[model samples]
Target: MTVVDVPGSKSLTARALFLAAAADGVSTLRRPLASEDTEGFAAGLTALGYRVERTPERWSVQGSPAGPPHDTAEVYCRDGATTARFLPTLTAAGHGTYRFDASAQMRRRPVAPLTRALRALGVDVRHEESEGHHPLTVTADGVRGGELALDAGESSQYLTALLLLGPLTRDGLRITVTRLVSAPYVGITIAMMRAFGVTVSRENTSRGEVFSVPPGGYRAADYAIEPDASTASYFFAAAALTGHETTVPGLGRGALQGDLRFVDVLERMGARVRVDDDRTTVSGTGTLRGITVGMRDVSDTMPTLAAIAPYASGPVRIEDVGNTRVKECDRLAACAENLRALGVSVTTGEDWIEVSPGTPRPARIATRADHRIAMSFAVASLRTPGITFDDPGCVRKTFPAFHEVFARTRAAWGLAAAASPDR
Candidate 1:
C-alpha cells in the first residue's frame, strides 16, 4: 500500500495566520497549508497592512498590529469563512475603514454573531447587505471589552473570531457563549491562542458560560502545524470500509484536532486502532458493527462516518450535531440524501442523521460542493463497486491531493479506477 502524508491543519493555519499578523515581530510558520482558504487569509492580512511572504514550505508574516492600510480598503475573502470572520475583528483593531466582502457561498454563511459581538465591543460595524450577514463596512475607533454573550451554534467561526480579538480589548474580554456547538474547534482556538502567549479560560459548569481572554498581544514563536486529523478521517474510514490497513503519519498521540477521535469511532465499529507518537494506524477486522453516539464535539467527522456506515452490519445513528446545518452545506441532509441515492436506507433530522447498512449500489454522488463531503464519499467509493463523484475537484479546498492519495492507497485493497462516468 502506498502511504501519504496529509497537509497541515486548516484550523491551525487560520489561527497561525491571525497570530502572525498580530504579533510584534516577524513570525515564521512552517508547513503552512496553501489552499484557497489559507491564501484568502494571507490576502486578507495583506489588505490589513501586514507584509506576508509565502514560499512552498513556510510563510513569513510581518506584523502590523497597529492596523489596516492608510486608506480605507476593501478586502475580498472569497469562499473562506475563516478569513471573512476573523479578519474583520483584526481590522477593527486598527485605524481606517475596511469593507469586507466574500463569495456567494461565504456570503450566505452567517456572520451576525461575530458582527454583533464586535459592535458590542464598541467597534462601528455596518452590514452593507442583509442584516447579520456579510458585505460589512467596519470603522475601528477602538474597543472597550466587557461581558458579552454570543450564540455561536451556527458556526464556531464566530467564537473563534471573538477569542482572537479579545486580547486586544482594553479590559480583556469576557465572552459568554450560549448553545455553543462544535466545542472541539473552540479547543483548537484556545490552544493556538495559548501557544501565541495569550491566556484564555473556559468554564464548563453550564452550557452558557464565560471565557476570559487576558489583555495582551500575541508573542512571536516558531510554530509547526500538526497534520490535519479531519483529512485523516477519510483515510481511516477507507481502511475500515475496505478491510485494508491505512496508517496516516504525522498525527501523533496528542494531536490538537478533535476529529482525531474519529479513529476511536472506527475502532468501536470493529476496526483495530493503533496510535503512536507520530502516526495512527487503522486496520479493519473485516466486519463493522453499527454505533450510536453523540458527535457534538466531533461533528466534522459525521460525513466520514456516515459514508462508511453502509458497510456496517446494522444502523449507525449520529446525534448532537445540529451545527452541521450551517456548514458549507446542510451536512445532515447531504448525508441522508446521498446515502439514499446509493440505495441505502437513511433517515435525517434537523440535527441528527441515521444510516442503515445495505447492499452497495453504484451511483454518482453529489458532494454539494463541500470538501468533506467529497473526500468522505470518495472514501466510500473504495468499497461500493461503481461509485463516482460528480465533482471530485471540490476537495481542493482542504486536501488538494486527496485523489492522488486514494489512488496510491487503493492498491492495498486490489481496487482500480472504475471508468468514472461523471468525469
Candidate 2:
C-alpha cells in the first residue's frame, strides 16, 4: 500500500484562523495548510490589524476579542469564499470602517445571505458596486447581538459567520436558521468554537434550528489541523481508477470535515475502504459501480466523483447539490461540459448531473481557475491518456504542489498520467 500525506484541511484552517484571531490570548495552530486561500485569510486578519506570525510548520495569531485593532482597513480577499464572507463578519465585532473586495470569481459567488444577516443585526454593511456583492463596506459600531433569523440555503458560511460572531457580541446571540446547506460545516464551527472555550447550544425548534451562543469571549488554545479530506478525494479517486491501494494518513474515525465521508461514497462505488484510528485506505477491486447519490452535504466532492464517473459500469447520478452552482464556478455544468469534451455521455440539471458509462477520450479540461476542478479532473486523467488541464496551477489555492504530489503518487503506483504539465 502506498501512503499519501495530504495537506491540512482548508475548512479547518480557515475556521481555526478566525477562532485564533478572535480568541482572548495568543493562539497557535500546528500544521496549518499553507496555500492561497489560507494565506489570504491570515493576510485579511493582518489587514484588520491583528498580529499573525507564520512559519513553515505552524501559525501563531495574537487574538483580540474586542475586534480588530485598526479603525479602518481595506482587505482584498483573494479567490477564497471563506475569506470574503467570514472576514467581513469578523470586522463587524470591531469598531472600524472596513472595506472588503475579492477576485472576479469570488465577487460572482453570492454573499447576500450573510450580508443580509449582518445588516439585520444593526451593522452598517453596504455593497459599493452591486447589492449583496463584494466591494462592500462595513461601518462597525460593535454588534449588540440579540435574536435573529437567517436563510443559508446557498451557502453555510452565513450561519457560520453568525455563529463565530456570537461570542464577540455584547448580549450574545440567538440565531434561528430557516434553511441550511452543508450542515456538517456548521458542526465543524461549533466544535472549533468549543475548542476556543465557547459553547454554542443548538436544537430543533418550530421556527427552525436554533443556536444559542453565550456572551463570554473565547480563550486561546493550541490546536492541530487535520489533513484535508477533500484533497485526499483526488488521491482516493486515483486508486479507484487504477485498481491500486492508497492510504492517506491523518484522517480517521474522528475526523471533523464532512468531506471525509467521501470514503463512504467510494465504498458505495465498489471500492474497498478501511478507516482506522490514524489513517484511511481505499483499494480498488477493479470494478467501479455507478451510483445515484444525494450530495447536498458533501457537494465539494461532487466534482471528484463526477470526474471518475465515466469509469463506472452503469450510470452515475449526483443529486441535491444545487449549492454547487454558486461555488468557485458552476460545478455541475463544468463537470458535464468537461466530461462531454472527453466524448463521454452526460446530462445535467440545475442541481444534478448523470454520467453514463463510457470510455473518456483525450481532451483538454477547462479548469476555470478553480482548484477543485483542476484536481478532480486530474483523477480522470489517470485513466484517459492525453487529458490535460487549461490551468493546472490553480491547485495552488489549496494544494500548491498538487501536480507534483499526483505525479509522484502515479509513478509510485506504476500508473501513467497526463493531466497537469508536471505529469
Candidate 3:
C-alpha cells in the first residue's frame, strides 16, 4: 500500500482568493494550491490593488473594503480559464476600468457567456477584439443587480463568477441559470460562499435554477482548502492499473470537490473503495470492468478513466462532457487521439467517448499542454512499458512536481522503472 499527500484544491484556491480579496477584512487560506493557474489569479488580484501576502504554508489576502482601488488595471490570465472568467465579474463588482486578457491558448476558449451576463447585469463591458471572447475591457460602475438570466452551458465558471459577486450588487441579485453545465461546481461555489459567511439561496423554479443572493457582504474568516480530488484521481487510477492498494490522505467522503465522485466511477469499474473522514483508499481487484457514465459534473477525471479503460474487461463509455472540448485543448479529441496512439480502440462524438479493451502498446503520448492529459496517461504507463510523454512538464500548471511525486510513489510500489526519466 502506498499513501500520497496530494496538493490543495485548485478550484477551492481560486474561489477562496476571489472571496477573500472581496470580503470585509483580512482572510487567511491554508495549504492553497501554488501553481501557474493560481499564481495567475493572485497576480490579477494584486493588479486590481488587492494586497496578497504569500508564505510557504499559507496565504493572507487583505480585503478591499471599497473594492479594488485601481481605476484602470490590465489583468493577464495566462492559460487559466477560471482566472479569466472569474476576474472580470470580480472586477465589475467594483467601480473600475479594467482590461482582461489571457494567453494564446486561453484566448481561444469562450468567455462570452460570462461577459454577456455581466453586460446584462449593467456593467460597461466591451469585447475589444472578439464578440464573446477575451481581450475585453470593463468600464465598471458596479453591477446594478436585479433579476438577470444567462446561459452557462459552455463553462460553469460563468455561473460561479456571477454568484461570487452576487452579494455586492446594488439591489442584491437573483440570477436564473438558463442553461447549466457542470452543476456540481455550482454546489462548490455555494458551499464556499457559505464558508465565508454569506448565504446563497438556490431554488428550482419553472424558469430555471434561481440563485437569490441578498445584498449582504462577506465576513472574512480563516479557511483551509482540501486536497484536490482531481489530482487524487491520477493516483487512484494508479492502483487500478497496477492492482495495488493506494490511499490518499486529507480527502474522503466529506470532500468538498465534486471530482471525488470519480471514486464512484472507479468502484463501478470493480475497484474496492473505502472512504473515511480523513482519507480515502482504493484497492484494486486485479481486474477492471467497463461501464457507461455521464461525466459532465466530474469531467476533469474523464482522461483518467479513459487511460484505465484499456485494462477493462469490455468497452467503457463516457458521455455528457462536451464542455471539455473548449478546455486547454480539445480534450475529447485529445483523449481519442492519445488512446488510439496507445493502441486502444476509441470513438468519440460531440460529448461522448467509448474505449474498448486492448493491449496498450508503448507509445509517446502528446499531452497538448494539458495537465490532466499528462497526469492521466502517466497512470497507463504503470501497466505498460515504454509509455512516455512528450509534454510532461505541462503538469506544472497544476501539479508542478507531478513526475517526481509519481516517481516516488511508483518506486514505493517496487515499480522503479515505471516512471524513470531515462525511459
Highest TM-score among the candidates is held by which one? 2
TM-score of each: 0.96, 0.99, 0.98
Q: Residue 336 error for model 2, in Å?
A: 0.6
For each of the candidates, the C-alpha root-mean-square deviation to the true structure, in angstroms, is 1.6, 1.0, 1.2
Candidates by lDDT, descending order = 2, 3, 1
Task: List the lowest-lDDT window of 10 residues for candidate 1.
Answer: 413-422
Question: Number of clashing pairs, model 1?
Answer: 0
Write one digit per residue (lDDT tens) for candidate 1, span 320-363: 88888888888899888889999999988878888998986878
In model 2, pairs of residues that clash are none
lDDT of 3 at 235: 93
Best by lDDT, which number? Answer: 2
Decreasing TM-score order of the candidates: 2, 3, 1
Give the Cα error of residue 98 in candidate 2, in Å. Answer: 0.5
The digit string of per-residue lDDT tens for model 3 on 141-211 reads 87778988979888888989988988878788898988888888889999999999889998898989899
Residue 216, candidate 1: Cα error in Å is 1.9
